[model samples]
Target: MREEFGSGAAGGAAAGAGERGPVVVALSGGADSLALAAAAAYVGERDGFAAAAVVVDHGLQAGSDRVAERAASQARGLGLEPVLVRRVAVRESSEAGGPEAAARDARYAALARAAREIGAAVILTAHTRDDQAEQVLLGIARGSGARSLSGVPPRRELGDGLVVLRPFVRADPSITRAVTEAACREAGLDAWRDPQNADPAFARARVRASVLPLLERELGPGVAAALARTADLAREDAEAFDAMVAEQIEEIVEHAEAGIAVSVAALAANPAALRHRIIRRVAEAEFGRELSREHTLAIAALVTHWRGQGPVEVPGITVSRAGGRIEFARRTGSPRRRRGCADGDRAEGGGARGVAGTPEAMEE
Candidate 1:
């Protein structure tokens, strides 16, 4: 536990200007998060960085406010200054996968807000290797591509000059739980377990409770570690491809009247993977729509397998090719929806207001 805490304490201090402000921890009252808050507070005191904790009450279940208060109390006991408890509304939906994603997006937004209010440059989260493994398994099951397989990133810029850090992404959940419990005991703090985590209605809960255990039994030990390793390798591959795509995009795409255009010749010259991504990027940027893989391949066919196929209608937009260019424009008379995808995390548009982070790796 001490060693794990030391590892977190050593990693967060960045060089130069970004290290000047406070470091904020998103405390969810779980063992992982409680450990993170305690470690961050300890690191701040020893290393001369200001530290605070924010507890976001999702208000999804009964007595959520009490949970938040308990978490805030724990944070205060840990010597985290300016501990805050924020209440957030989690949007509900009958659509599959919508509710979970909405809660994740809302939690991140609240964390970002808390960081801004405290003038903090970095916000730390407590996602362990177990979480990463489950995320990877889910991504694989969905066939969402390597981006989804990459799982939660260790660090990401959340705009407003703030960065979110997942310090325990590489750490084992069991080790984190033990470490957090030890730290809480030492500090005389009690951690609260959210009942939702055990609810079978949630896909993640089922994955954690059943699917992973089955995999472990069938595949032997270290399955979770292997999955986390796979995510790291996939992330590296995705980053390289993203760099290549960024380099090729500007030369191949242009803004046209009431729509955005991409050169068919340039797209055809690239590999299918690159072309498919280009098509999706253009659609997402101009039309504010996330194209399904099938839709993306269909659009790429206009270049690779041109058969004079007419414009295809995607969620909020129409895609067509004319004069050696593929164009995406909003569908006429369509009502404007919120600027996010069905999954809720990926921003629909390319502008700054769009959600921060990478595009969704898979479509519904």
Candidate 2:
């Protein structure tokens, strides 16, 4: 593993000689993170790159600061230079997602800040294969799209030129935990265990404690690996779809008065899946909104089943068909204009794709 890291970091440095900066590890006082810190430090030394560790204390539980300090101590002992412990405030949210999401967002922001201060270009996280499986399961439960099922991305831009890398996403958590604990024991360090991990109140904790174990027992021991593999395949498929969308989107879309307009005939000519994707893309690109599956399908109906239906009202925008085009305009208080198809109004050029008359409507 050390040789692999050394070769990897060497290749990275060889790409841009002067751009090599310190490698920053996110240490959470847990076994996974500790192992990551140790590996990063060893690799940095072997490859002539600087290594640092940042311990983000979310202050969500009692004695969190102490845990951060202990983690920092272990990082320094592992020969990681410039060990840092950053304290972050987690705001409580009553929104759909729980406090875990809020804390994770805050923690990543803090880690990015630390990286900027330390002149680091990369931040490494300790998310393992088990974590990927859990994310896949959660996305499945939520009925999210393929992108959501893709699970934790292996790499992503963290803004300000920093990149977040999850190197352990392919490694099993049990292996990482065992390796980390053995490393700590050899170095005479004690890793702190978070008590919240056992609390059933948290959905993730319940999944970890009950759901994964039961599945492994009933369905054999390979279920987690299978889920992780599914995430990888989904990510590749989603990336291909994104590339396709980017290549063809501009041809059928144009800027409208207050929003964007797409060609109805052009959208209808494509397959239903691509048409739905294009509609969602337009909503996101023009209005900075992610349309729900229902809203997307409703808008698609204006293209496929133009039954003189009124405008479909989605959050922050309205969709209507007129002038052989589907217009997505911003919602306003004043009355707006809409065009509907009369009975027996046939589509123009293509088969069944036109709204003959104009029907004016407004969303207040």
Candidate 3:
């Protein structure tokens, strides 16, 4: 963890430049976000990005509103104006699916709206390299294939002309926590921890609370560093692969009444790895969300068992084949009733739930 805090803190990630414009900090009251808010406010003032903060209250607990208010106060303490805090709803789905994911969806949706209302150019998050490693592990657990394992990007376009930048994805979580602690000490403050962090039922909680510690014991130090480095390498591989796939996409994929269609024969001609990559991407472009490595193999069943009908659902999306082209379409409607697939999260997408950090390796 590498961090400097308070008046002496290094700085926040650049949120563009202007003599007078705002950068909205999506402060979650967590150490990473608190650090990000303070750093942004400090740097924003000097670097032309007027720092504004928004703390979303999911209302999941008794003291959520208080937390938001305190977060707002902390933002003001950093020379920022009063923060705009909003209360959002988090509806629960199935037991396994739960409300946490929905809370995140609702939270980000509010933040996006907040950023738009204030005309802020950038939305900064507090995702650190450790988080990225957990994501890669979670992707592995789901057998989500290579792209999911690559983890989050440092800079990505959010909806409505907002860009989300994660400056600490290259840094460790401890660094930001240290900074936040230093800042809080200076201000005489305390922090809250989410109970979800210790819930063994959630895979990520187990990874963070158990597996990470075990790795430290067995691997003898540098375990987190190793995982973080793995994320970097996977990210590089995924980026290069996407670029190549984009170039050859026209050669392999085409629009059809069935939505995006891929030539199964063309796919078969590529190496096994490239074929799986093409399948995962084609699935996303046409149906939203990725096809797991297991699902990708099932997709190949369309080629191996192509006769009349070879169709199966890949969780949120459906895969089928007609003639020489493999077709992936959203399962919500038939071809007669379909218009298009929504732009999905690169790693995971469902109609209701956006892709988030889910940590592990999965195989079929």
Candidate 4:
């Protein structure tokens, strides 16, 4: 366990903590989080760095405050300093993506606030291999592309100079939920189990309770590990593709009047995968919208199969071809026009006017 904790990004952060703020563990009193707290406390002491814990109470369940307090107490017992407990209100309706996703957003926001208050540079989350497997399976069920299948990354920047790290999830041996529970038991800690984990109303709960088990039973075991491995490989590919897009996007993209424009010739020059990614990347980076696979392909068709197709209206943006460039503008902005051509130049001979639906698109 020490070897596992003393490796990876968490280990590197701990080694360099002398010049930075303390490392914080996100504690929920669950088995995985409890085990993480224990490992962090021990490793921090041995490595001469400050370790702390933050417990976030969503207040979704009755007695959630008590649960938070118990977790805080456990953190204190583990010799962690300045344990903090935060209670956050989850706004389900206002937040996009379902209740679970909304709750998660709120929880992470609270965690980020806590980190800021304490001057913490790194926040450790105890998402195990099981969680990774579940995320990949969920991505597959949604027919998502490589990005979604990549699952949660090992580390992501939460704020300026602050990052959230999942040590157990990306561990070489891949710590499992059962392993965390055993660790908690060995340490004489009574871990709290969230009932929502097994509730049927949630997609993740259904995947954990039914889908994964069925796959493991029929496939003769190791299915979960394989899924987690798949996430690692997918993440590598996604990262490489993202880097390539970053390198070429500025060269191909240009700001138009009240909109953005891409070189149609440039887009057509790339392969389908790269072309689609570039289209989605434009919408995401400029307009804060995620384009679905169907939407991306539809937008791609304007460049690849151009027979003077009209503007393709996706959520929040309208994509259209004008001469040698593809224009993207806000849906509510001025109507798109073909450059160097007459005003309102519709598709030649009225080619198919592509209008994408509003359904959330799969990520690439």
lDDT of 4: 0.80
Looking at model 4, how many pairs of residues clash? 1
Residue 91, model 4: lDDT of 83
Q: Stretches of candidate 2 above 4 Å error?
A: 1-18, 94-96, 170-188, 332-364
TM accuracy, model 4:
0.89
Instruction: For each candidate, give its TM-score against the true structure.
Output: 0.86, 0.83, 0.80, 0.89
lDDT of 1 by residue, 245-324 (tens): 88888788888796888898999899888888788777776667666676677678788888886766565676788979
**Candidate 1 regions with alpha-carbon error over 4 angstroms:** 8-10, 13-19, 93-97, 170-188, 334-364
Per-model lDDT = 0.73, 0.73, 0.67, 0.80
List clashing residue pairs in candidate 2. 338-359, 338-360, 339-359, 347-354
Query: Which lDDT tens digits does candidate 4 get at residues 70-139?
Result: 9999999999998999999888753245566566778888888888888888888988889888888878
Residues 1-364, model 2: lDDT tens digits:
4445334322332222125578788899887788777767666676577878999999989889889999999899989889999899888564313466667778888999998899988888877777778778777765657887898887778777888877776443333344556665665667788898888887667778899889999999888889989999999988988887876686888877867888988999998768888888888887886666667888999999999987776656778998789999987552343354232211111121111010000000
lDDT of 1 at 137: 83
Please give me the total number of clashing residue pairs in predicted model 3.
11
Q: Choose 1 or 3, whichever is better by TM-score.
A: 1
Candidate 3 wrongly placed segments (more than 4 Å): 1-12, 15-20, 94-96, 171-183, 186-189, 304-323, 327-364
